[model samples]
Target chain A: MLLIDDLHASIGDSEILHGVSLEVPDGEIHAVMGPNGSGKSTLAHVLAGRDPYEVTGGRVIYDGVDLLAMAPEERAAAGVFLAFQQPVEIPGVPTMYFLRTALNAQRRARGEEELGPVEFLALVDTKRRLVDMERALLDRAVNDGFSGGERKRNEILQMLILEPRLAVLDETDSGLDIDALRVVADGVTTLRGPDRSALLITHHQRLLEHLVPDRVHVLAGGRIVRSGGPDLAVELEAHGYATLDSPAVEPRTASAGTASIGTISTGTISTGTISTGTISTGTISTGTISTGTAR
Target chain B: MTAMTRPATARRPPSGTGVGMGVQVPERAREPEWLNAARRQAVAWVDANGFPSTKHEDWRYTKLDSVLALPLAASSGRGAEDGPGSVSSSDLPTPQLGVPRIVVVNGGMVPELSTLGTSLPGGVRVESMAGAVRRPEGRFQQLWTRRLGGYPHALRALNDAEALDAVVIDLPARTVVEDPIEVVFVSMPTGDARWSHPRLIVVAGARASATLVETYLSVAGAPSVTNALTQVELGTEAELVHYVLQGERTDSFHFSSLEGHLAEGSRLSSRLLATGGRIGRHEVDVVLAGEGSQVDLDGLFLTGAGQHHDNPVLVEHAAPGCTSRQLYKGVVTSDGHGVFNGHLVVRPGADGTDAVQVNKNLLLSERAEVDTRPRLEINADDVACSHGAAVGRLDPEALFYLRSRGVPEREARAVLVSGFAHEILERFGSGPIRRHAEELAAAAGLIVLDEDHCSSGAVTAGTVHPGRGGRAQ
Candidate 1:
């Protein structure tokens, strides 16, 4: 459902993401793993259309629309959600009020009727339980004085309410405790369906344990060096990114419109392996997807 | 404490000090001996020393050149052809239900329009300053004479010389006023330039507690000026909550001086919201006189094109173990100017005094300007005093956060701006007054409160006293 083709982007004088490409088909979750300063957060910001990150070259295509050409708010209306790594604190704005405004704005943009206070409150009550968010927190100012876990859970709650077609999680697991991580993972997994997809960005493989992804890609030196099954996450967790013998110069996919995406299955498949959720690297090499094989 | 100036003998007759100088006094006939003597001393002071210029230290940031140049005359208490009577009453806020309301048109209190005759709680007296002057004895006599002893302010002296009437509220010892006393001053400018002096005196006796609200509003019309004065005296253990809402027409001018005295163990909290007038200025001078007295002064000013607002606050800690805090915020846009001058004084023998002053401004346009000054004069040791000032535009990060959530840029800006001003607005005791203030903020574009969120239906307007019909235009 999403295609990022040779997305070269920069912030000021520094070029962060240099010619990176990735693709996630319909109804699948992908994990992007990278070490410190490998531009994981930068990639997420660029996808969300944040400013100060100039996309010098390449394009982002989501559901056949030019995603990079859209503003941040327009992208949100078009079913592209970016869960910020650090949610901002908006004082004097009630949390529930902001959430309802956002939901109504998206709905109005999509030519749907807006929900009233009663209906909106009922929806929040149901989704808030999914993340175990305190009811009192919803009455306070948005993210004001909220603990780290509460902010993360609030983000997950927003994701569940918005129910976007494509979700980009940017290091959402960084500051969460094990319990919060499991709650956030479950929230994201519940949003999974035949028409939904998510890109989980993190440095640790622990989050993958709860919500296993269909693909794992290791990002280094501003480029995705290797692509494999979920076993790669376990292998990398055992032996860090230093052990991966990635090629020094990898071929870049020129354009998302012309690039051949032959191996990507557009149809829904079984989740038999995700329930077991554990397969060794030795048993997954036959099904491993590599950047060298995309062309 | 600064010594009060002794009343000087009348050098010139009241007639010589009248008319062309922007001040007009009534006939001295039938006036009390002491009041006549006081008005004579005030008129002589105004004649001897004209209005102060910007060169004066206190008037440095505020220029009186424009006001001093206007061709001004005393307002005719009766409505004129082009006065407030010409405008519809729908623009004014409806008075809250069951509240004791005193309605002042122009400068004089219209007894027919006022609603506080014999309905006051026990030990409380709400009367006109004119009536109070007739029975000047005991506390009323003492407080009124003490005010006349100080004639250093030129404009205040002018007010004393010309103001014909005022609202006098007396809360006797141990009296607890259940409902706030609402004083609405409506200015109706005549065809020619006119000015009015509105005065208020509130005395909360020992252990007495009450809330007072003073709202200044005007109908849109020719140029006019309103010079107002309020005196508050809190006795031992007394508590008072005072609010001044100044919302005049933008082309009119307004100036108010609030002087308060807090006794031992007494507390005073005052909030001032200034959002209208061509040049709106309010000077607050509060003295924490008795031991253990406390005071809090909070203010918010919103200035748009062709408008200027100034707040000069002076807090004096006179006795030991007293506390004072001042927080003033300003939002200036396009051709607007704002000024905040907070002066704190810790006098001798006033040890253990705690004071804090903060002034913050948000300039929304390149042409907008604000000047903030915090001055501290400490003569006592072992006192805690601090002051700070900040000036900036809206937080761009907060703006982006709101916009990123799909809120339009205009609505997002409104949210952030409202948030900035909410710090002061929320302090306005909740209900109709606060809701009216929010509506004023929204009208001035400082905020955009959601219709349902504001609960404005509770404060349905149009119940205001319709403007009096005088000569047709």
Candidate 2:
């Protein structure tokens, strides 16, 4: 369902991914493994259509539409999801309120009937218990004051709720303990279906052992030098990046759309304080008390 | 004291004869020598300052033609000869628990309706301002005279000179009172112009605690003008929660000045609900005296149909480790106007101090208006402080959200506006006071929460579903 040709991208003036390409057929898992600066995160951010990252040269195709031709929110409504490497905090807005708003926003875009509070609350209740998150956490501001593991767990909960068709898991297992790792891995496993495809981006072979990938690609110097089965993760983890293809050899897709694109943007918020002011006065900063229009 | 020698800038006397008739500051006799001297000085200063007009910032959006045009003189009022009419507490509030309260009628203290608390904490002294002056209260002479007159308030200084009666309470160290102390002011007006000034000085010793409630009550058919000054003092670790409710007569004008000092680690929470009077002005000044002290200042005002209410408040944090918060809300309708000016000052060297001030207003009519400003002055770099003022319509989106949920339009508007004022109500800390304000707002015709005003399920998220806001939540 997802196809990426020789993609070359860059954030700003500098290029990150030279020419890297990959594809995930229906109902399959593809894992991208790389060293510290191999652009593992760059790929995920590029796919989600994060701005500031100039797609200097490349084309990305998902299903039959050009994935690059949509806004970030449009991509979201189109079923493209990217689990952040670091969840952000948004203060003031309650978790439940934000979730419902987002769900409705997507549903409206899709022209689907929105769910009522009763139905929405019921769905959230079932999902909360599935990830062992208490209802109190959902009721409080999103990700505010949450521990490292809790934020990761909350991300999984959102992933489950959004139910994207093409899910990109970026460093989802970084801060998890043994128990949390299994829970996260289990969430991913349960989400897999015949019509959905997922791309796992990771640095360690440890998480690979849990959510085993059907195909593995070794990334180095902004290029995917080699490809192998799940064993490739174990090999790269133990031996490192010495076997990267020579300079003469082309990395992958030569077209511009699917590359790392130099820079990246976008982050999540826990909650937001809407403290809005809608005074109908003419000027905001310098209006005289003459009219006292604020009243 | 006469109006001719008074400063040219002082407020012009109400045109012709004011609603107070023609009575001005009254000249008294047989009064103590010191009391008479202060009044002369006050009336002179007022003549100089003159009542401010729309041309001035503080009075912006507030009209003074009818107010300034009144023909007021130098005297408060001729006690017996000049009389607007007769009024009583019965004309104001419903009778209460025969808890005898000292009633001040037409600027005169009527001890006939007063009594000493049956069970008073030892060292707790409560009496009239005149009574204290008569007996000297044994307080150091320098402490009372020097500080009071050295920086006397223009109007207060004048009121002090001619004022007839007041309430004073002094609690000794470590004394904690179990019952509330109430002071009722009933204005009985006569003649053209009448002014009543009730001054209170409350001193709480170190570690002492007390709750003082001062209520302003005016009867029907009696139109008058009242100017009251109340002061509070706290010792180290002492606590005080003072509340004031203004329910004066319809034709009356009310002005009060509240000044309090909070000592080391001491705390104070002061709230006022001003829903009466054609024109009302309340000014509160709170000074944080010692380290680790905190103050909660809240005021809620509702005005309708030609009524004007103004609250000018200040909270000063002087020492390190002190905190203060202020929230003021107002709901205005008809051609009424509301003004809220809050000032928060954090002095230098006062580190670790946190201060926040906010003012919110809801205008129920296109003709009605509100002017809100939260001013913050911080000189210390190590502390945190902020102030914000917002005046807006009800949240259309939230309104829609509530409507789609089965709430009717009118009922939803009422509910939404009520929620807008909820924060201040919660801090009012008085159940009866809160309910009274809500009922007053509804009765003024700003909203109709009654069953007939709203249809069940009139509020829905989507079309045919609920509120007028676009799209569903």
Candidate 3:
């Protein structure tokens, strides 16, 4: 359903994503795990068509259409949704009003009949129960003065209403408590179907426990270094991302079983050094990843 | 009576022409001695000062060149060729709030057109200004003599001198009138260019509470001008809510001055909405005379195309422990000009005073202009005072958010502009008035959107006062 081929993007003078290649077939859930500054959020923003991120190279194909060529609203109409890391606060605009406008807009763009107020309200009531959103929150301004957990739940509510073909969750579990995480996870899990696919971007494997993924890819040095089953998330959580940086690492295919671990060379890589370190390593691996043969 | 064919140069009105041309005045010999003397003094004052020009600081942004050159005449009390006799109920600017309405046509009270239910509370007196002036006794005498003291502007003086008939509303001590008293000033200009000076005096005794709505509307298109003045006095612990709605013709001019004095523990809230006229200026002066008195002044002006609107508000915290707040917002589009000048003065020894003033404007077109000035003069050592003014376009982020949701660009811009004006409209305490304000704001938003999308239609074509004939100017 989604194909990202050697997508090289940058913001200003710094290139965040270099020759990153990944793909998620229909009816499957894929998780992209990386440490801080691993281009996890950058990849999500680029896919959502945020203007600040300049896509310098490569193309993204979704449902046999050029995704990069479409505007953000067009992408939304074409069934691509991005649950932002931090939902923007739009003052003076009621949540229900905003949601109704958005839902009708996307529907209209797709040549579908728009929903009337009564019908939209009924649909919103049904979806509100799925995420346990407070009834009062619907009347308040969109995400204005909302707590961290409410914003995430609101995002899920939108996802349920839009019912997009592909969903991208960026750090959805970062600021959530245990209860909120479970609620968000339940919302996402309910949307899983044969025709719908999701790309979950996170640093922790805890979210994976609730919404298990069919494929887990470790995005390091701006490239997918390894691909495996859900077990990769458990491995990364057990021994951090330090072990994934070893030389002569084998690229595990999506259907591969447990692979042998290489000998560890314990070298202290200080915190805050990953951003610059990953850029240098990414430059070296650009030649190979650009061929679209990394996955 | 000659029609104003084109913009006239700056010139003075005919000399010795009693302010407003003395069109509807009764015999001078029949007037009370004190009232006649007062009028003579006011006329003298106006003739001495003449009409204010751009050289004056208060009238700097609002030019009176074309307005002064019009053949200014006062309306005869009888219905003119172009008058409210032709104005239907649907032509009114705001929705009928079912209040006790007093309709004044051509500067005189229309008793047949007005409706004051028999259930009016005791100690409440609503009478014509001419009637009140004839009976020179107690409260009415005191209020008439103290007509907007201290601020001697030219137009106000003119209104005082030529005022043939005015509205006098007096509420005695502890009288609480549940129904609002609405004063509707309908200006209908005949072929000759005319001006009307309507005076309104409201006195709320100690612990008295009332709501007053003053609506200025022109039903005719003749080049007419309205220079209105309203004086309000709130006694100790008294509360009054005043609302002014101006919807004159685009070719005409409207100028209004409202002066309010609040006594100890008194509370006054005033709101002004200007959405009409080629040249509109509203000047509000509020004085917190006693300790613990409070004042709130909120205004919204929406101008488009060749329209120019100005609001100059001056609030004085004269006593200790007094508080005042002012918020004025404007939306100007397509060569429209808006001006907001707010002055907050905390008098000497008026310690413990708290004052805040904010002026924000939105320009929807490249040619739209706004001048916002907030002047804070604090003399007290122990006081909290702050003033801020901002003039800019709509928030691009807010616009993008709405557009990203698939709302058309024009619709998105309209929504954002409505939101900006809603902040001030919502401050109105009355439900019907607030709803009326919302309607005006929506109309203004549509006008802005239409201007943005199409260049052919003129902005002033969408008049707030619908179903009106005769094009002023």
Candidate closest to the true structure, highest TM-score: 1
Q: What is the DockQ of candidate 2?
A: 0.03
By DockQ rank, best first, the candidates go 1, 3, 2
TM-score of each: 0.86, 0.56, 0.83
lDDT of 1 by residue, A28-53 (tens): 99999977667788889898888778
Candidate 2 ranges beyond 4 A from true positions: A1-295, B1-30, B54-57, B61-63, B71-89, B92-100, B137-154, B430-473
Instruction: Supply every candidate's count of residue pairs whose N, Cα or C atoms clash at under 3 angstroms.
Output: 0, 58, 3
Q: What C-alpha RMSD separates each model from the true structure?
A: 11.7, 13.4, 9.0
- lDDT, candidates in the order shown: 0.77, 0.64, 0.74
lDDT of 1 at B18: 28
TM-score of chain B of 1: 0.88
Best by DockQ: 1
Better of 1 and 2 by TM-score: 1
Clash pairs detected, candidate 3: B221-B470, B221-B471, B221-B472
| iRMS of each prediction | 3.3, 11.4, 6.8
Scored by lDDT, the top model is 1
The DockQ figures for the candidates are 0.25, 0.03, 0.17
Candidate 3: regions farther than 4 A off: A12-15, A218-226, A246-295, B1-30, B76-85, B147-149, B446-473
Q: Which ten residues in a row have the lowest lDDT in candidate 1 chain B?
A: B464-473
Worst 10 residues of 1 chain A by lDDT: A274-283
Per-chain TM-score of chain A in candidate 1 equals 0.84
